[model samples]
Target: MFSKTCEYAIRGVIFIAQKTADGSRIGIKEVAAGIDSPEHFIAKILQELSRKGIIQSQKGPTGGFYLDAQSRKHTLADIVHVIDGDQIFTGCGLGLKQCSETKPCPLHNEFKKIRDAISKLLRSTHLGEFSEQLEHKLVFLKR
Candidate 1:
């Protein structure tokens, strides 16, 4: 799967997208509460997303997080790349530094297949879909 940070980031984005999809802004407290993440940690994640242009944020009493039309097109892979890099797609399964085709680890082949499948999924799953799913109650973002 994904790192804890990436997991929180995805949840945070989905929560924000669900709220913003209805043309409303959501505050950090609400987003963190919705996703069951720490407010400060989620704030940092939100700041990073904003910095990378994956989402937008504003300051002041009415300021909050919201997704733009272009941002709605971003896929899970995009957020993964921003927050976790491509390591999840390229790293060794057994955490071996030199594990590869030529110097394959015991689990390298199987793990490669799994990693590729995850990469394909992330690439194909856009935030908009998750937003819609959240809207329709097809999936739960928080426990």
Candidate 2:
């Protein structure tokens, strides 16, 4: 599972993609509202994303967040890496510091399988695809 911050980042990116696809730029306030995240927290997340080049940002009256062509093609994993690093894919389950293949945790094998599946899901899912889902009202970024 993703952290709360990661969850908001994913939702914020997808929401921005949806709006950008419709030729709109979204500010932190709009992105936060769209994804039902706290405005201040979402602002930091969005700034991190922009710094990581996952999403585009501008400054000025018309300045806001928008996805470029490359940004539209970004996968969930990309955003995850920016916000949460590779812990979800590389860290041990059950919070074991030394757990590994040789020194397996109790739930290591099962958790590895689950983690691999989640990784694959993130790598294969593009922002644009989620944007489409949101645009069509088939799925919502916010709970």
Candidate 3:
């Protein structure tokens, strides 16, 4: 499961990716409204993304947020790392810090495989490609 911040990050990336190359910049309010997210929270997420260089932000009249060329090159892993950190993908599912193949937890093998697959996909697929797949219903978000 992902955190709210992670969800917002994904949505923000996808939204920007969809409108990429249109020279359109969106404010935090607009992005929150479009994604049906809370304004303050989305703003914080946007700030984090900006700090991480995952999205570009401008100030003043023609300023807001937009995906730069770097955003197009960014993978889901990058976003996740920015918002949720590597721990989400790297930690043991059962909360066992020392769990490993030799001394596997009950769900270690299964969870590890799933985690690895998710990590692989997130690391390899860019936001642009992810947005296209999402638009085509190839990928579905539960919430």
Candidate 4:
């Protein structure tokens, strides 16, 4: 599961990708409204993303957050790594520090399989692929 800020960042990025496809930049207010996130929170997330090169931003009248076609190729795992690191992939399901194959937790084997699947899903999926689903209402970013 994603943290609330990660959730907003993912949603905000998708919305920005959809809007920026026309080659126009959008401000924090617009991104916040598009993704239904708080302006201040989304602003911070976007700024961090811009700083990290996951997304791009500009200043002045035409300044805002936007992603180039190439940047859109970044995977969901990249954002997850940026915000949450690899903790989910490497942590114990039962919250034990020493949980491992030899010293397995009760849920270790089962949780490993589930975690691997999720990791694969995130690593293999790109941000660009979601714009069409969102543009056509095939997916919803917010409940």
Best lDDT goes to which candidate? 1
TM-score of each model, paired residue for residue: 0.94, 0.94, 0.87, 0.95
Model 2 weakest 10-residue run by lDDT: 127-136
Query: Can you write out model 3's per-residue Cα lDDT over 21-119, one digit (the tens) per residue?
Result: 476788877777777888898898889888888988899998988887767888889999988889768889988989988899999989999999999
Clashes of each: 0, 0, 0, 0
- lDDT, candidate 4, 51-122, per-residue tens: 888999989987888999887999888888888889777888888999989999999999999899999998
Model 4 segments more than 4 A misplaced = none
lDDT of 2 by residue, 24-134 (tens): 688888888888899999999999999999999989998999999999889999999998999998888898899999999999999999999999999999988876667
- The 0-to-1 C-alpha lDDT of every candidate, in the order given, reads 0.91, 0.90, 0.82, 0.87
Model 2 steric clash pairs: none
Better of 1 and 3 by lDDT: 1
Top candidate on TM-score is 4
Model 1 lDDT on a 0 to 1 scale? 0.91
Consecutive 10-residue window with the lowest summed lDDT within model 3: 134-143
Better of 3 and 4 by TM-score: 4
| lDDT: worst 10-residue window of model 4 | 83-92
Candidate 2, residue 130: lDDT: 75
